[model samples]
Target: MSVSKLAQERLGDYILKYCLLFEINIFYFTFHTTELRSKHSTKYFLLCCFQTCFHALCRKFPPSVNYRKRFLTELIRRQETVDHAPLDELYDALADVVGAEEKSECYKSYLLPCGDTVSLLENVALISEGTTGLVTWEAALYLAEWALDHQQVFTGRTILELGSGVGFTGITICRSCSPKKFIFSDCHTTVLEKLRDNVQLNGLTEKMSPAVSVEELDWMTVTKEQIKEMEVNTVIAADVVYHPDIVESLVKLLSKILSGSAEGAPKILICSTIRNSETYSGFKQQLEAAGISHHVITGPVRKVFPYNRDSFIEMITLYK
Candidate 1:
């Protein structure tokens, strides 16, 4: 595909994934044609791209404020490089995405390198509905990047994700990693609802991709029987160590799940953002107390997603 086709594909994927009604109709215009000797077609195509992007910013489920703001700002900055004069729509779009009020519900879409995309409808507020689990964390992005880099870790393995927030990591893995099964587990009802929405949004439901399921898991009260029944051989958690109590609960639950695995003790991978030193240390202390051995992992040379490369994201490989 040509460069413009690739761009349209990516943008179309994002629009469909997020259900960006305001931005969905822009790609109908011809953007990848090379034989356009007439300036009319070229101008029309460019207008479609920029105008739809502006309309997207004015929509309810537009991209994140920071992303839209930066995109608009950069467009205004680089408009002079193009063959056409800048349109007033560019400044209006900048103001729309920048000055729009935050909505309670919005979408976040991630375009994968393999032309697949993972999108989510999430709460704009961090602590929405009395739970922080509604928002995707940095560690989840980091873990998804790591998983995409190391596909062998999940290939043909039944994977279970603990504390899957909005199903970003799970959906990404389902698309990129060749896993036998993927079970996404979380506790919050609101988060679970949105998680299932995201999973279905990515078309990973049983109807489309038979190997995915969303389950409600209470880490503190889960029984060994449930873990055994899952028949999972790999476990993963991302950004689950925010609270000390939660860390204790997670370690205890992980110890039980790992010890009771019928598939020869599943491989456990925990990815966390080291936001607070003491909280992370408490997590380590809990892991040690549970008699589970874990070590930091550091072998991925490249990342698969666009995220903060300099963030303090770390992965620990745990074993029984």
Candidate 2:
């Protein structure tokens, strides 16, 4: 069978597993080619697809060395089944990755439905720099997917994202939802630094019209005056309700932000992975005690990014 046919069959697997490349419209290749140019036209055409995909993979948003090595190895293995001679570009790409120095940091790119990519520089380890915020979490992916569907909530509104981590949810909203301004906040110095890098990596700098800014926001000590200064219409946070102390502080912070808003209480959205039922319930209880009403948002139908789907992630909208 031809490479295009083979790729068509495995496209879904590639997207779900690796998420290294966007969906390539195979019809583009077939429709554009009127006639075979050479005896090796099929091989050449397949190589063109690889080159186009890998150009973005290598230059724009390269995955880790390990992922790249595995991808190239699989490609070469598939090629061997069809032809005896090896593709030089594939071999060279593999060699480069094999020889490249491995590092703690790597880039991950998520393909959006609008054909734009939200690329982030993430730490390979889940916990790095004495914090979990260096890497994007599953809850952030779930929140981002939800945001894409509810763009109207964000459009023309200023948003404040608490515990922004690596800025995945904020950047995705800035790119797609048309938010008027986005403020990414985290308490940790390391997390704030990486969050700034990710915001810049996605090209949502402060200079943009829908202004983007990163700030240090410690929920435990943040005052009502500080919340009032932000002038945000919406507040969001993801994966921050895991710890009891954090949940307490987060509830207090949300109370202050809601009560202090100049116009009115801003809309609040908190997405959390239900890692511990006790902790999740504690969060809800605190919200109720603070006179904040919240309800679980209906989960988005479209899953845009690859994440741990088995994790029970819930989105909650809050009002004061």
Which lDDT tens digits does candidate 1 get at residues 1-320? Answer: 23355555554444333323222222232223442334343343344445446444335335656556655555454443443556576667667667777568777666677876676887778897889999888888888888889989898888999999898898988999889899999999988999988888788876554389999999989999889999998999998988876777888898898788765888899898888999999888878888888989983566555555678888999985
TM accuracy, model 1: 0.78
Model 2, C-alpha of 44: deviation from truth (Å): 8.4
lDDT of each: 0.73, 0.78
- For candidate 2, write residues 277-303 as lDDT tens digits: 999999999999999999889988897
Candidate 1's C-alpha runs over 4 A off are 1-61, 64-70, 80-85, 89-101
Query: Cα RMSD to native, each candidate?
Result: 6.3, 5.3
Off by over 4 Å in 2: 1-18, 21-45, 48-53, 82-85
Q: Give the TM-score of candidate 2.
A: 0.85
Best by TM-score: 2
In the predicted model 1, the residue pairs found to clash are: none
